[model samples]
Target: MCVEKTPWELVIDFHGHTCPDIALGYRVAQLAQREMGIRPAPDSECLVKAYTQSCALDAVQVLNKATIGRRALIIEETQHHIYQFHFTGTQEIHQFTVSSDVLDHLKALQHPDLSPRERQNKVLEGVQYVLTLEESAFCQYDKIPGELRKL
Candidate 1:
């Protein structure tokens, strides 16, 4: 029998590679969707403000269908794993940040001693480790205080 991939599995394929950041983004997006009581963008009906230009951005685009081309996804260069999603036609906004422990693991993957091949293997392992985490293990959602501006 043919097995169906979950939405996040499809996100992994669309992103062309797996990493801890992307996995964390996937979880964050899911949390935002659930909290905002919104579904994936059927068109260009939502906007995403991602505060980092990392692999996680690709997952956000894929999972939320919020692409820069559609003026629905905005990238801001920052040092944090923060993302805010706003559904068009409503004041609802959802904000999330990856847990510090997960971020520490991602930083550790950048250790200079590892060879290129070793780094590659370590990244794969990190991705697997992140994928195995329960929802609360990788991210924290913050109360949406106000509108998030694009930068």
Candidate 2:
């Protein structure tokens, strides 16, 4: 039977695998959408600035429609899980900074000694950990004033 995949499933498919990074990105994208409340207007667009490069970004590109090719997704090498969403024509920017607790936990999962199968299992565990994390514990939410237009 051909079944329709859920949005999360589509993100996983677009990302090519399920991992903590993608899970983190998916959560950030979903939260950003909820926090923003409304969709963009005809003249306004939602732009994303990501501080660090990770597989998580694939989720943002999929769920937020902020693709790098379109110049709507900006990525930096700051190496942090911080994301800023700017709604053009608005006065505020929404920033989400992933917490240290979550970061540390994900880091602790990495090990070079495990077998391939073991590594795969750990990766799956990490994905589950991130997907089920409490929303409030996932990241710190902040509303900062900034220039909204990307240009």
Q: Write the per-residue lDDT of candidate 1 for residues 20-60, one digit (tens) a residue.
A: 77877777777777887754465427679988888787777
Worst-scoring 10-residue span by lDDT in model 1? 37-46
- Candidate 2 residues lying further than 4 Å off, grouped into runs, are none
Tell me the TM-score of each prediction against the true structure: 0.79, 0.93
Note the Cα lDDT for every prediction shown.
0.77, 0.89
Per-residue lDDT of model 2, residues 35-138, tens digit only = 98786687777899999999989999999888888888988779999999987888789999998899999889999999999999989888898889997888
Candidate 2 local lDDT, residue 10: 97
Whole-model lDDT, model 2: 0.89
TM-score of candidate 1 against the unseen true structure: 0.79
